[model samples]
Target: MLIGGGHSHVAVLRRFGMRPMAGVRLTLISRQAETPYSGMLPGVIAGHYTRGEAHIDLRPLARFAGARTIVDEAVGLDPRARQVLFATRPPIGFDVLSINVGSTPDVSVPGAEGAVTPVKPIDRLLERWRAVEARLLASDSPCTVAVVGGGAGGVELLLAIEWRVRHQLAAAGRGAGHIRYGLFTDSAHVLPTHHARVRRAFARTLAERGITVHAGSAVVKVEPGCLHTADGRSHRVDEVFWTTQARAAAWLRDSGLSVDDRGFVRVGDTLESVSHPGIFAAGDVAAVDPHPRPKSGVFAVRQGRPLTENLRAALAGRARRGFRPQRRFLSLISTGDQHAVASRGPFALEGRWVWRWKDRIDRAFMRQYTELPPMRAAAPDAAPADEMAAPGQVPDASMRCGGCGSKVGASVLDRVLTRVKQPAAGRVVIGLDAADDAAVAEVPPGRLLVQTVDFFRELVSDPWVFGQIAASHALGDLHAMGARPATALAIVTVPYGIESKMEETLTHLLAGAVAVFDREGVVLAGGHTSEGAELALGFAVSGDVAPDGVLRKGGLRPGDCLILTKPLGTGTLFAADMRGRARGRWIDEAVASMLLSNGPAAAAFIAHGVSACTDVTGFGLAGHALEMARASGVGVELDLSALPLLPGADETLRQGLVSSLHSQNARAADAIANAARHAGDLRFAALFDPQTAGGLLAGVSCAGAEGCVAQLRAAGYPSAAIVGRVTPGEDGERWRLKIGD
Candidate 1:
C-alpha cells in the first residue's frame, strides 16, 4: 500500500498500472486528490502556469494503476499489527507499506501559525493567494506584503508575488507604486546556498523591482498587520508569507518508524525505512542515512524510479537496489517574468530562453503522470465482488466477464434454477419467478408478496460497513413500493484464505448485516456462501404490502412538491475515494449518509400523502428522478442550489471527480432543461453522480412538503429538503428537468 500521493508514489502507481503483478492487490491512501508539483509553483504564483499544470491528478493515475485508492490521510502505523490507522475509519491492513508523504513548512514562530500562510501545501497556499489578490484589488490605500524566507523557495515566491501584483494592478488600470514588498531572513545574503553569480543576478533583479531585502534578521514573530524581526524592529505589512523551512509531519514520528529529529523517516540507500522492513520512504518526508541531502524537489523527483524498483523487490522478497544521489544537478530558478537563471556546480546562466527550457522540462516531467497511457476503467460502482448486480450489459468494464468468474466454490444455484417440475395447476399457490428474490403467491383475502434483491461488489474495505450498506440497499425496491421488509437470504463471497481467517471475515460481515436486519425486524433466512478472489455480499429480500397499497412511480400530481431526503454526490465522492483524492471526512460523511435507511423517510412521505417516491441508487438523482418524472408524466424544476449536498461534494465535483457510472447516468442530461447553460457549473455535474443506498426522492402534496421535511429531519435526516416541484408536462412537452442555481 502507498501512503501519500507524493512524486515517488505516483511513479510506483504508474509503473504497476503498466505491468500489474497478478494476485497482488495495491491500495493508495492520500489526503487529497491531487499532489502539487513543486517545480512549477513559482510559475503558478506568477500566473505563468495554471493550477492544473502545477498539480498531478491522482484519480486517473490510480485508475490507470488498477489500484484501490482510499482517500484518507495516515495518522499512525502499527508495524506489528500490519495496519495503517486513519483519522476516521478503522485501521487498514497492509502486507507491505511505503511512505511518500511530503513535508510542510515549519510555521512555529509566534502568531505565524494562525496569521501567516506558508508556501508549502501548495493547495492551501493557492487559496491564500486568491485572498491576497482579492484584498489587494479592493484596497484603495497603499498595502505592504512581506515574505518570511530568503532561501530559494521564499526568494522565488516573493519575486513571483511581486510580478503578479504589479501585472494585476496594471491590468486593472492601477499602478504598482502603492504596493511595497519585503523579503526577511535571518541570513546575511539572499540565495545563500546558490553560487555567487546566481545570487548577484537575483539581487540586481530584486533591486530593479523595488523590493527591500532584509537579510540580517529573521521574522521572529508574525502579527496581524505587521512582522517582528529579531533586531528589535517591526515591519508593518498587510500580509506576511512564510516559506523559511520545510518541516516533516509529526505523524511520521508517532508512526513507530525510525525518524530523524525533524520527524522525517530515516531511510537506507534503497529508500527503505532503516527500522522497518518492507516499508519504504521517499520525497521530502524521508532522510537518507547513507548520505543525507537537503530537502529539495530535485532529490524527490530523482528518487521515484529507484523507490519504485526497490519497493517491488522488497515486497516480493527480492534483493533491493540502492539509489545514488547526483552530486550536482541543474537548477532552473525563474525570475517571476519570462526569464530564468540556470545554475549547476558554480556554473550559472540567465535569460528568457532559460525560462522556456525550465517550462519545457517541468511540463515534460508532469506529462509522465498527466499524459498517462490509457487504462481499463476502474469503476467504483461496478459489482465489487458480487455483492449486487444488474441484468444485461454492464457499462463498466469491471463487471464484465463474470460467467465462470461469477461462480464460487460449488454449483450453488444450478440445482434450483435448472430443476423444473410440472406446475400443480390451480393449486400452484405461488408461481415461479426465478429472477425475483421471492415468487408472488395467490393469497386469500387481498394480500400480495413483494420480493427484491440487491448485491454489489464491496465498496469499502471494511466488510462490516459493507455488510450494513449492502443489506440496507436490498430494501431499495421494497421501500420504493412502500412494502415492509420481512425476510432476507444472503449470498456471500470470501477471499481464498485460511479457515480461521475466512470464518472471522464471514462472521463480521454477517453480524453487521444481521444487526441491521434485527432493527428492521427482518428474518435471516438460509443463504449461500462461497470462496472467491475478493470480499463481496448479496441479499435477496422479501417484504409484504397490501395489493392496492403498493406505491407506484406513476402516482404524481402537477402541484406536488418534490422532497429529497438526503444529499447527493456519493458516486462521485466514492469514485474520488478510489483515486485516493477524496478527503477522508468526505468519505466518512458519505458512508454515514449511505447507511441511512429510507424506511423512515418513506413512512414520513406516506404519512404526509405521497404522490410518487423512489429511493435514489446506482442510477443517480437525475436518472432516478427522471424515471419518476417520466413515469408520472410530469415536469420537474430542481433548484440546483437547494439540492442538499454532502460536505465536499461540490469541491470534489469541481476537482473533476466523476464515477465510472457517471457517463451512463449523465446520458439522461437531455431530460434536463438548460443543460448546456449549467454544464460548466459543478452543481450541475453532480446530477450525474451515482448514489448507493441514497435518500428517498419523493413527490408529495405542496401543503405537506414542509411538514414532511420537518418530520424527516426530526427523524434524523437533517440533510432532507424540498428540492423541486412537479409541473404540468405529461405528453406534449415530455418529461423536463429544469435546473435553478
Candidate 2:
C-alpha cells in the first residue's frame, strides 16, 4: 500500500502500470486527489502555468496501475496487525506499506497557526492564495505582504506572488507601487543551502526588484496584520506566508517505527524502514541514514526508481538493492516572469532560456503520469500464489471441485457469520438465528407482497462500500413500489483465497450489508456463499404493501409533474473511473449518492400522492421513462435543460466516456419523437446513462409537485428536481418521449 500521492509515489505508479504484478493488490491512501509538482509551483504562482498544469492527477494514475485508491488521510498505523488506520472507516490491512506523504511546514511559532498561511501543503496554499488574491484585487490602499523564510522556496514564491499580483492590479487599472514585499529569514543569506554564487545571484535579483530583505531576522510572533522579529522589532503586514523548515506529521513519532528527532522515518540505504520489515519510506517524510540529504523535491523525484525497484523486490521476497545519493544536482530557480537562474556545484547562469529549459523538464515529468500509454490485455498466466494460497498449498484450477464442493468451507462461513453482527429480527420466521434449509417469512394479512431481486459484480474496490451500494440498490426496487421492506437473503461470491483471507472478506461484506438492513428494519435471512473467480454480491428482497397503496409505472396522469429524487451519472462516472478519466472528487460524490437510501424519498412521494413511480436503475432514465410512458399509455415530454446531473458527469459524457451498458440503454432513444434534433447535446447522452442505486422517478399532481420536491431536498435529496411533466396519451404515439428545451 502507498500512503501518499507524492512525487516519488507517482513515478512508482507509472512504473507499475508499465509492468504489473499478478495477484498483488495495490492501494493508495491519500488526503487529496491532486499533488502539486513543487518544481513548477512557483511558475503556477507567477501565472506561467495553470494549477492543472502544475499538479498530477492521481485518480487516473492509480487506475493505470491497477491500484485501488482511498481518498482519506492516514492517521495511524498498526504494525502488529498489519493494518493502516485512517481518519474514517475501518483500518485496512496490508502486506507491505510505503510512506511518501511529504512534510508539513513548521508552524510552531507563537500565533503562526491562525495568522500565517503555510506553503507546504500545496492544495491548502493554493486555496488560501486564491482568497488573498481576491482581497488584493479589492484593496485600493497600500498593502504589505511578507514571506517568512529565506530559503529558495520562500524567495521564489514571494517573487512569483509579487509578479502575479502586480500584473493583476495593473490590469485592474491600479498601480504596482500600492503593494510592498518583504523577505524574512533567520539565516544571514537567502538560499543558504545553495552555493555562494547562487546566493549572490538571487540577492542581486531581490535588490533589483526592490524587495526588502531582513536577513538574520526570525519571526517570534504573528498577529492578524503584524509580526514580531526576534530583534525586538514589530513589522506591520497585511499577509504572512510561511515556507519555513519542513516538519513531519506528529503521528509518525508514535507509529512505532524508528524515527529521527524530527519525526521523519529513518530508512536504510534500500529505503526500507530501519525498525520494521516490509515498510518503506520516501520523499520528505523519510531520513536517509546512510547518506543524509536536505529535504528537497529533487531528491524525492530521484528516489522514485530506486523505491519502486526495492518495493517490487520486497513483494517478491527478493533482496533489496541500495541507492546512493548524488553529491550534486542541477537547480533552476524562476524569477517570477519567464526568467530563471540555473546553478550546479559552483557554476551559475541566468536567462529566459533557463526558464524554458526548466519548463520542458517539468512538463515532461508530468506527462508520463498524465498522458498515459495504452494498456495491453493481460496474457493467460498461472494463478498467483502470493496472496491466494496458504502455506504448503498451491493454486491450481484443475484441483478445484464442482457443485456443492464449490461452496465455501462450512467452518469458515460459520466463523464469518459469528464475527458479523446479524440484523435485528423482524418478520423473519426462521432466519440466520436458526439452522434451517430455507428462510421462512410471514406477511401481514392486510398487505400484499412486494418482491424484487438485484445482483451485480463489485464496481468499487472497498468491499464494505460495495456491500452498502448493493443493499441500497436492492432496496430501491421495494421503495419505488412504496413497500416496507422486511426480509432479505444475500448471495455472495468471493475470489479463491486462503481460508483466513476469505473469512475476513466475508465478514466485512456481511457487516456492511447488515448495517443497511438494520437501519431499514430488514432481516437478513439465510443466503449462499461460494468461491469464484471474482467478487460479486446480490440480494433477494421481500416487502409488504397495502393492496391499494402500491405505486406502479402505469398511473401517470396528464399534466402531472415528473420529479427525480437523486442526480444522474453513476454509470458514466464509474465508467470513467475504470478508464482512469474520472477525478477523485467526482467518484467520491457518486459513491455518496449511491449510498443514499430511497426510503425517505419514497415516503415523501407517498405523502405527496404520487400518481406513478419507479426507481431508475441499470436502465438509464430514457429506458425507465419510456417504460413508464408505455405502461401509462401516454406520450411523455421531458425538458432536457431541467434534468439534474451529478458533478463531472457532463465533462465525462462530453469526452465520450460511458459505461458498457450505455449503448444498450441508448436503444430507448429510438422511441423519442425528436431524438435526431437533440442528440448533439451532452445532456442527451445522460438520458441513456445507466445508474446504480439511482433516484426514483415519480409523477405527482401539479399542485403537490413543488412541495414534494421541497421536502425531498430537506430530507437529504438535494438534487431532487422537476425534470419534466406527464402529457396526454396520443393514439398513435403510445410510448413516445419528447425532448424539449
Candidate 3:
C-alpha cells in the first residue's frame, strides 16, 4: 500500500494503474481526498486556472490503478508487525509500504502558532488565501502582506497574491497600489537556495513590483499583525505567511523508524528505510542518498520509477536496485501573473514565455494522471480457459452476488493465516484455528455477550482497503453498544481467480482486517469462506460490556443532541465509481471516512452519557435516523445545513449520480416528517445516498452535548457535529424525522 498521495506517489500510482504488476495490490492512504500539485498552485492563486483544473482527480486514478484509496492520517507504524496505524481507524498491513507524505513548514518557531500562517500542506494555505481575499474585498483601505522566508515558495506566494489582489482591485475600479507586499529572508538575498543569477532576477522582479525585500533579517518572533526580526526591528503587516524551513511531519518522528535530526525518514540509495527493510520512504519525507540533497519536488518526481521498482522487487522476494538521484536540477519560479524565472545552474532566464514553458511542463505532468490508458484484452496465449469458457460455465463480470454467496475460497483463507503470529494468552480462548466453524470464547460470569455482524461488498477495488472498511463497519455495532470487542471471525468472499491471484487478494484483505482487529484488542478466529464472482467481507464480532454499561438504541429521551461522528456519502461516490466517473480524490476521501471505525466516537459518546446510537450504513442518513427515532420512541428534527457531507459528495449529487441502493433508501424517506415540504433541496436528496462504513449517530444528553462534540473534534473527527435533536414522540408508534432549514 502507498501511504500519502503527494506528487511523487501520484506519478507512481498513474504508472502502476496504467500497467499493474500481476499478483500485486496497490493501495493509497492520504489525509485529504484531493492532493493539490504545488507546481500549478501559484497559477491557481493568480487566477490563471480554476480549482478543478489545478487539482488532480485522485478518484479516477485509484480506479485506474485498481487501488483502494484511504483518506486518513497515519498516526503510527509498527514495522516489526508490518502494520500502519491510523488515528481513528484500524491498522493497515502492507507487505511493501512506501511513504510520500510531503513536508510541511516548520511551525515550531517562537510565536509561530498564531502570529503567522504557514503555507505548506497546500490545502490549509488555500483556505488562508480565501480568508485573506475576503478581508481585502471587505475593505476599501490599503492592505499590507508580509511573506517570511526567502525560498522559492515564499517568493512565489508573495508575488502570486500581489498579482491576484492587484488585478482584482483594478477590476473593481480601485487603484492597483492598494496592497503592499514584503519579503523577509534570513539570507542576504531572495531565492537563497537557487543560483546567484536566479536570485538576482527575482530581486529585480521584487523591486519592479514595488515590493520591500528585507534580507539578512530572520523572523525571531511573530506578533499580532507584525513580525519581530533578530535585528530587534518589527515589521507591521495585516497578514504574515510563513514558508520557511520545510520539515517532515511530526508523526514520522514517533513512527519508530530511523529518522534524521530533522525527522525525515533516513533512507539509503535504495530508498528502503535504514531501520526497516520492509518499509520504504520517498518524496519530501525521505532523506536521500550518498550526498545530502535539498528537499525539492524534482527529486520526489524523479524517485517514482525507482520506488516502484524497489516495491515490486521487495514483494517478489528479489534483490532491490539502488536509485542514483541527480545532483542538480533546473528550477522554474513563478512571478505571479503569467511570468516566470527559470534557473539551470548559473544560467537564468525571465519572461512571459518562460511562464508559458513552465505551464506546459506542469500541465504535461498532470496529464500523466488525468489521461489513463485503456485496459487491453488478454492475448490468446495468455488468456485462461475461464476467459474463453462456454456461456453457461463462465461468470458474468457485472451483477455480482450479495450476502454469503460472495466469499473467498476456504483453501485461500487457510494459507493467509499461516503468516500471522497470533497473540498468546490463556484467557484469550477464541483465535484463528483451522478446525473451528465458529469462534469459541470463555466469558467471565456477570459479563454479557454483545454480538453484531456487518457485511458489505467492495465499494472500492482494493482488497486491502476493503478489508479495513469492512472491519471498521462491523465493529461499529459493538462500539455503539459501548462494548469492548473481544474476538472476530471473518467472512470474506474473493472473486474467482488463479491460485497466485487468490492468495494475493486474500493476503491483503485479511491483512487489512486483521490490522483493525489487532488494534481493537480483538482476536481473529476461524470463519468459513467460498469462491464467488465478487469480493465481499464481514465479521461476526463478540464484545463484552458491563451489565449496566450497555447503551441501547431505545434509550434515547426527549431533548437529546444528535451527534454524527463522521461525514456521509460513500454510496454515491462508489455508485459513481462503477461508471468510472468518480474522481480519484473523491473515492479516496470516501474510503478514508469509511475506514474510520466508530470506536473513538462511541467511547466519547458513552463517556458523555449517550443514551442511544447506531451507525449509518447501507441505509441513508435519513433511513438510519428513522431507525433511531423509531427505536427511541421520539421525533427527530435535523438541521439540513448542519449535516456533515464528505467532500465532493454535493457535486456528485448535483451531477445526478447516486448509489444503486439509493432508490430503496429514498423509499424510507416516507418516515420523514416533512419529506414533501423540502423535496426540492438537493441537500435533502442526498439524505438518501447510502453510506458504507459511515459514522455513529448518537443521541446524547443536552447537558454534555457541546463538550462531547468539542472533544470529538479535538480527537481528529473534525467533521463531527450536532446534526439534530430528539423530541417527545407524538403517539404510541415509534417516531418521526423532520428537516429544518
Candidate 4:
C-alpha cells in the first residue's frame, strides 16, 4: 500500500504501470485525488502554468498501474495489526507499506496556525492564493503581505504570489502601487541553502522591487493583523504566508516508528525504516539517517526508482538493495516572471532561457503521468506468476475445503463483530448481540413489514465504500415503497486470505454498512460470512410502512408527471473508470450521488402525494420506467433532453464505454416508439445505462410535481426533475413509451 500521492509515489505508480506485478494487489490511500507537482508550483502561482498542468491526477495513474486507490487521509498506523487507520472509515490491512506523504511548513509560532497559511500542501495553498488575489483586486487600500522563511521556497513563492496578484489587479484596472511586501527569516540571507552569488542576485532583485528584508528576525508570534519578531519588532500585516522548514505528520512518531526530533521517519540508505521491516519511507516525510539531505522535490523524485526496487524486493522476499542519494544536484529557481536562476554548487547562471529550460524539464516530468499510454490487457501465456503471499505462505486454493469449511473462522468473525459498532436495537428483537441463528424483527402496530434483498460483487476496490453503496442500494427498495427502514442482515463473501486479513476486510465492510444503517436508524442483525474467490456483500433489509401509505408502481394516472430524484450515468462513468478513461472528479461526483440515500426523496414524494414510485437501479431508467408504465396500464412520454446526467457521462457513452449489462437493458428501448430515430443520440443511449444505488422515479399530479421536486431538491436531491408525463393507453398498446424533444 502507498500512503500518499506525493512526488515519489507518482513515479512508483508509473513504473508499476509500465510493468505490473502479478498477484500483487496495489492500493494507494491519498488525502487528495490530485497532487501538485512541486517543481511547477511556482510557475502556477506566477500564472505561467494552469493548475491542471501543475497537478497530477492520481486516479487515472492508480488505475493504469492496476492499483486501487482510496481517497482518504491516514490518521494512524497499527504496526501490530499491519493496518492503516482512517478517521472516517475502518482500518485497512497492508502487507507491505510505503509512506511518501510530504511535509507541511513548520507552524510552531504562537497563534501561527490561525494567522499564517502554510505554503506547503500546494493544493490548499493554491486555493488560498486565488482568494488572496481576489481580495487584493477588490481592495482600494494599501495591503501588506508578509512572507516568513528565507529559503528558496519562501523567496520563490512570495515573488510568484506578488506577480500574480499584481497582474490580476492590473487586468482589473486597479493600481497595484498600494501593495507592499515584507520578508522575514531567522537566517541572515535569502536562499540560505544556495550559493552566495545566487543569494546576492536575489537580494539585489528584491531591493529593485522595493521589498523589505528582515534578515536574522524570527517570527515569535502572529496575530490576526500583526506579527511580533524575536528582536522586539512588530510588523502589522494583512496576511502572512509560511514557507518554513518542513514538519512531519504527528502520527508518525505516535505509530512507534523511530523518528527524528522533528517527527520525520528515520530511514537508512535503502529507504527502509530503520526500526521496522516491511515498511518504507520517502519524500519530505523521511529523513535519511545515513546521508541527510535537504527536504526538496528533487530528492524525492530521485528516490522513486530505488524505493520501487526495494519495495518490490521486500514483497518478493528477495535481498534488498541500498540507495545513496547524490551529494549535490542542480537547482532551477524561477523568479516569478519569465526569468530564472540556475545553480549547481558554486556555479550560477541567470537568464530568461533558464526559465524556459526549467519549464521544459517540469512539463516533461509531468507528462510521464498525464500523457500515459493506453493500457493493454496481459496475454494469457505471458501472465506473471502469482505473488499472493509468496509460495507456501498460505493454503493452496485446490487444497481448501468446501461446504462448512468455506465459512469464516468463528474467532475471526467474533473479533470483527466485537469491533464493529452495530446499529442500535430499534425494531430488532434477536439481533447480533443475541447471536441467534435467525434474526427476528418486530413490526410496529398498524405498519406492514417490507423486505428486499440485494447482492453484488465489488464494483469498487475499497471494501468500506463498497459496503456503504451495497447497503444503500438494498435500502433503496424499501424507500421506493415509501417504507421506513428498520433492520438489515448482511451477507458477506470475502476473498480467501489469512485469518487476520479476513478479519480486517470483514470489519471494514461491516463498519461501512453500519455507518449507513446507524444514520438511517436501521438495526444490523445477525449475518453470515463465507470464503470466496472475490469480495462480495449484500443485505436483507426490512422496513415498516402504513398500509395506506405504501406507494406502488401501478398507481400512476394519465395526467401524472414523472419525476426522477437523481442523475443517471453511473454505469458508463464507472465502466470508463475501470479502464482509466474517466477523470477523478467525475468518479467523485458519481460516488457522492450513489451514497445519497433515496429515503429523503421518497419521503418528500409521499408528502407531496406521489401516485407511483420506483428506484432507477441495475435495470436502467428505460426498463424500470417501462415496468412502472406497463403496471399502471398507461403510456409515457419521456423528455430525452430533460434527463439529468452525471458528469462525464456523455463523454464515456460517446466513447462506446458502458456497463456489461447495458446491452440487456437496451432491449427495453423496444418499448419506446422513437427508439430507431434516437438510437444514435447519447442521451438516448443513457436511458439504457444501468445505475447502482441510483435515484427515485415517481409520478405526481402536475400541480404537485413541481412542488414535489422542489421539496426533493431542498432535501438534498438537487438533480430531481420532471422527466416525462404519463399518457392514456389503449387496451393493446405495443409501444407504450415515446421520446420527446
Estimate, for each residue in 1-741, the C-alpha lDDT of model 1 and write its tens digit. 899998888888888887776545678888876789998999998999999888887766776777765666788898878788866344666767888888888999888887988887788899999899888877868899889888889889989999998898889898988889999988888888888999999999999999999988888877789798899899899888888878888877887889998889999999988998888889899999988887888888889889878877976679999888987889899889989999887999999999999999999999998777655565332323222123332223343345455444333233322222122232123433233444333433465778888778878765667878888888767888898887677788776543334554565567667767767766555466776666789899877788877888788789899999989989888877676566555777888888888889889988999989888888888888788888988888788888888998898888887888999888888888778898887878888888888888999999989999999999999999988888887455558787865
Looking at model 4, report the run of 10 residues with the lowest lDDT sum.
378-387
Cα lDDT tens digits, model 3, 368-449, are 8777675344311122324423455545545545567555545656667775545644235655653455567877689888
What order do you get sorting by TM-score, best first?
4, 2, 1, 3
- What is the Cα-based lDDT of residue 148 in candidate 3? 89
For 524-565, candidate 2 gives per-residue lDDT tens digits of 888889887778999999999999999999999889999999
TM-score, every prediction: 0.73, 0.92, 0.66, 0.95
Local distance difference test scores for all models = 0.79, 0.88, 0.80, 0.88
* Candidate 2 positional error at 657, Å: 3.4
> Clash totals for all models, in order?
9, 0, 13, 0
Q: Per-residue CA lDDT of candidate 4, range 1-741, in tens?
A: 999999899999988888777667788999888898988888888899999888898998998888878989999998777889999887888889999999999999998996788987777788888898778888789999989998888888888877888788788787688999999999999988889999988998888776899999999999889989999999999988999888999999999999999999999988999999999999999999988999999999999999999888987888888888888899998889878999889989999999999989998998899888897775111222234665676687667787889888899888898888574479888888877789888999999999999999887777888889998999999999999999998899988766666787899889889889988999889788898777899999999999999989888899899999999999999999877888888888898899999989988887888999999999999999999998888988899999999989999999999999999999998788878999999999999999999999999999888888889889998898999999896556522888976
Give the clash count for model 2.
Answer: 0
Error of 1 at 167 (Å): 1.1
TM-score of candidate 2 to 2 decimals = 0.92
Residue-level lDDT for 281 in candidate 3:
88
Candidate 4 versus the native: TM-score? 0.95
Q: Which stretches of candidate 3 lie over 4 Å from their true place?
A: 176-178, 375-454, 461-535, 538-572, 588-741
On TM-score, the leading prediction is 4
